[model samples]
Target: MTEQNEEKPRNFHEMELDDRILKAIAKLGWQNPTLIQERAIPLLLEGKDVLVRARTGSGKTAAFAIPVIQKILNIKQTARHQEIKALILAPSKELCHQICGVIKDLTIKCSQEVRCVDVAPQVDLSVQKPLLVERPDIVVGTPTRVLKHVKAGYLDLKKSLELLVIDEADLVFSFGYENEVKELMGSLPNIYQAILASATLSEDVKSLKSLVLHNPVTLKLEEPEIAPESQLTHYHLMAEEMDKATIIYALLKLHLIRGKTIIFVNTVDKCYKIKLYLEQFGIPTCVLNSELPAKIRCHSVTQFNQGIYDIIVASDEKALEEPGNYGEKDNTEAKKSKRKKDKESGVSRGIDFQHVANVINFDFPLDAQSYIHRAGRTARGNNHGSVLSFVSIKEKPLLEKVENRLKTGDNDSIFKANHFKLEEVEAFKYRAKDAWRAVTKIAVREARLKEIKQEIFNCQKLKSYFEDNPTDLQVLRHDKALHTVRVQQHLSDVPEYIVPPTLKGMGGLTKRNKRKHDFRSAQSSASRFQARKSNPLLSMDFEGFSKKKKKKN
Candidate 1:
C-alpha cells in the first residue's frame, strides 16, 4: 500500500532499451517507477549481479524485464543477432510465455524499430537451432529445456553473453533441482552477470549465492504486514474429503467468489479426484496436474490465465513443478500421501495468481511451510486474498502447528459449513446463470473422470505393494515399464525434463527413499515429524517454544 523507496533513472532513451519500450511505458500512462523497477533496474543496467526478493505483483517482472530488454537492444545496436546474448530462465512454460509476451508488447509500444521473440520448449526442437542461429535476441524458457538445448549442443554460449537470470529460484531449488541448477550455472561462461529473483528465499537459495553471483546487490521488499481486509477472508472447515466437496459446492452456489478459482490439493491424484467430485456437483472445473499432456496442461493454464475457465482444481505439486520439478515425476512421499508432501513436491511454492480472491486448501498443508506457500499465492501484488483450509480430526496437529508457526493471531477453531453467509453468492448466481451452469457441468464431468483415474492409481499401487519387498523383480520391472510409458507419454507431450526413465540412480532420490520406506526401514518415532523440515527457514517443533534457528545442520 505504501510507495516503493527506489528512484527511477532519468534518461530512459540512453539506457539501451528499445525506443519502443520507452514509448510503450510512456503510452501505457506509467509516470513513475514502481519500487522494484526503480531500485532494481539501475543495478541491472550497471551489469551488477542482483538478487531481488520482492512480494509477488510488486512489479518484479518489469523490474527485471526492463533491464533485459535494454540489454537486448544494446546488443543488437552493437553486435549481430546470430548468437543468443541473454537467457531468462523462468520456472514455468506459462511464465516464460507471459514474460515473452510482455517483452514483445512493450517493444511494440516503446518505438518503431524494436522487435522481440519468445522461445520455449513448446516450440519445435528442430526449429530451435535455426531460431538461435537466425533471430531470438532474447531467449526465454523453462530451465530444463533450455539446459537441454545447451547440453545437446543446440545452444552456443561461447559468444559474448551478458546476463543469466534464474527467476523463482526458491521454487527451482526447493523442488529437488539444486543439482540441476548448479550444473547449469557451472556451464555458463565465467564473465556473464547473474540475477536471481524470487518472492522468498530459502537456505538452498542462500547456498546458490556463492556459486552463481559475485558481490551481488541485494534488493528486498517485504510484503505488506497487513493483508487487504476487503478482498480476502480466512476460514477453516473441519470436514471429511466428501463433505469438503459439498462445502465447495455450497460456496460456488452462494457466489460472491464468482471468477475462475484454483482449488489447491496436496497431491497430484487428488487434483483429479477433486475436479471430478466438484464436476459431479455441477461446477464447471478442470484438473491441472503434471499427469496431463503438456499441451493440455498449457491449454488449461492459458485458459485459466485468460479467465476463460471458472474453476481449476489442481495439486500444489503439479502447478508448481513444471520447469521447477519437471514432468509427472512425483517424489516417493508424494506417491504415499499425494495429499500432503511439504516443500519437496514444489506445488505449494509455485502457484502465482494475482486475481485469485480465495485459496481453498482442499486438504490442509501438513506444516507451516506449506501454509506460507499456499497463502502467498493470493494476497499477492498488494491485493487482499482469502484462505479456506479444510481440516479433519486426523490433521489437528498439523493445523495447530501451522497456527503456531505463522503466528496467526486468530483462535484455532473448526468452522462448520453454516458459518459462511452465501446470500451474496446467490445474487451473482442469477447474473451469470449460464456461466455458472456450464462450470457446474464441467465440474461434474471432471469428477467422474477423476474417480476413474483414482481407481486406476489405486490398482497400480496395489500392484506395487503385492509384488514383493525390497527386491521384487516382477513388481519393479512392471512398475518401471509402466513408469517408462507414462514418462514417455508425458515427455512426448511436454519434453521439459529429459531425465532417463529410471528414477533410482539420481542423487535426488536419497531423501525420496526415506520418505517411501516401509514401516520396517523407517523409524516409527514421533521424532521424524519433529525433525522434519516444513520450511527451509523454519523447522517443525511439535512442542511450541524453540528459538528460531537459521544455522544449517
Candidate 2:
C-alpha cells in the first residue's frame, strides 16, 4: 500500500488537469492541497467514485469540490438551467449553504463553467426554479428537500445528473434518512459517479460505500496529535447544579480570555438563559440555535461571522443541522425519543467554528463522541483553541470516562478561571470582562428557581399529607428543604425585590447601593416578564397559584 501510494500523485497540481482549472485553483490562493484533497482529486477527476473519512475542518469540502468543478468545466453544459449536471447533498442547511459559498468563490475565478443552486428544507422550490433555471451546473441541497423535488418531478435528476456527491454521509445516515437517501440514489442514473465524505465513518457509511461506490479511492486524514509543547489545555470543574452559574461568573471576571468565545449547552433554554445572564451584566452577545427565526439565525451567524459579537451560545447539534425544535419537544421522553431518532437519522451531527477561540461545556454530552464533537468546535482548521467544562461531582465520573476515551490520561486545567483570564464574556460592553460569569450565575439561579418550584410542588403534596397524617419526619424534612430552596430562589431570582439590610455576614453592600438595589429588584420581575414574554425559562409558575386563586374565586 505504501509503495502504491508512493507511485500515486503527490499533489492536486500534479493531477492531470486543464489550465482553466489550474488558474481557478491559483486564483483562489490555496496554499497546497490537503492530504485528502491530494489523494482523492485524481481518482475523482478520472470519473471514479471516492470515499473520504476525515476529521472536521480537514478541507473535505474542497477535496471533493475541486474535482466536481473540474468535471463541470470539462463537460459541455448547455446554457439552459433546467438541468443540474451535479447534485451535492449535505446533511445540514448550514453545510449546504457553506458548500455553496465555497463553490461560488471558486466559480468567480473559473471560466463561467459552474453555478450552484442551494435548495434547503424551508426554502420554496418554486421560487428557486427561476433562479435555478438560470444556472445550469450544480445543485446543492439537504437530502429530504432535494429528494422531494426529485420525486415531485421539479428536478431533472435522470437526464442531467452526472455526479452525485454525498457530503457528511455519516451525518445523513445518522439522521435516519438512509431510506430516503437510498431511494434518491436509486433514482439517479447508474452511470453517474458517486462521491462520499464524512468526518467519521460508521456502519451506515460502510453499507453505503458497498452500495454506491465502485473501485473508489479511500482517503483518511487522521486528527493531528496534540503536540507536547502545545498551549491548548482541557479541564472540567466539579460543580453542584446550583454552583455552575457562579463558576461561569468567576471564569469571566479574570479577563484573560476574549475574542469570539463559544458556550455549548445541551438545550436551547440554557442557551437563552446564559445569553440573558451575560447581557444583564452588560455583555454584548448573540445566540445560534434552530428555534431562532430563520432570518434572525442567518443574521446572527452573519454577524458572528463578521466578528460583530463576542460570544455565541448554542447546542452542539444546532451548529450542524437545520435550525428547528428537534431537541425541545414538550414531552421530555418524547424529546429524548426524537433526539434518538434524529441521531439515528444523521441530522444531529456536529459543526466547527472558525473564529471560536474558547469552548465552555456548560452541560456534559452523553458520551465520548459527543464530548469530542463539543470540544472540536474550537481548535478548528489548524488554529489553537481552548475547552473549559463545568461538571458537577455527580458528572465527574462521566468526564473521567470521556477523558480516557480521548486516550490522554489527564489533561491539565486552570482551576482558577480567574487566574488564567481566559475570556472576557462581556462582549458588547467593550470592557465587560465577566460576562460569562454573570450568565453562569443566572444559569445557577434559574436552576435554583426550578428546584424551588419542584420542591414547592412536593411541599404542597406534603401539606396535604400532613393535614391527614401529621408528624411525618420524612415529609417534615422535605418541607424544610422546600422552604430552604424557596428562600434561596427568592434571593437569586428576586434579588432586587429582597432587601437584605445585612447579608448573612457582610454588614451591607452600602446604604445607597442597598436602596438602589431594592428599587432595581422591585422593577426587575415586571421588566423581566416584559422582556422575556412567555418563555418557560424566565416565566415563573407561581407553584399552583392559579389553582388557589380559582378556589378563592
Full-model lDDT for every candidate: 0.55, 0.57
Best by TM-score: 2
TM-score of each: 0.65, 0.68
Candidate 2: tens digits of C-alpha lDDT, residues 136-211: 5888887887888877667768777889899888777766678888888767887889999987778888888887
Best by lDDT: 2
- In candidate 1, stretches whose alpha carbon ends up further than 4 angstroms from where it belongs are 1-19, 23-33, 80-82, 110-124, 224-232, 318-333, 336-354, 408-553
In the range 1-553, model 1's lDDT, one tens digit per residue, is 1224554454555455556677887875566666667778878988889898875556677778788878767766666444566788776665666667667757775433344445554546766777666545677877676777778777766565678887777667654666667677756787988888877767767887777878888887654422433334556657665455545654453232433356888666556455444433334566665554343444455555554454667676544233222223444445454332223223344434545556778877655556666776666554455677878777667777665654434663322122332232243223233322333434544543554355345445554565555344222110011110111111111111321222224322233343332111225223222322221111111111122322333
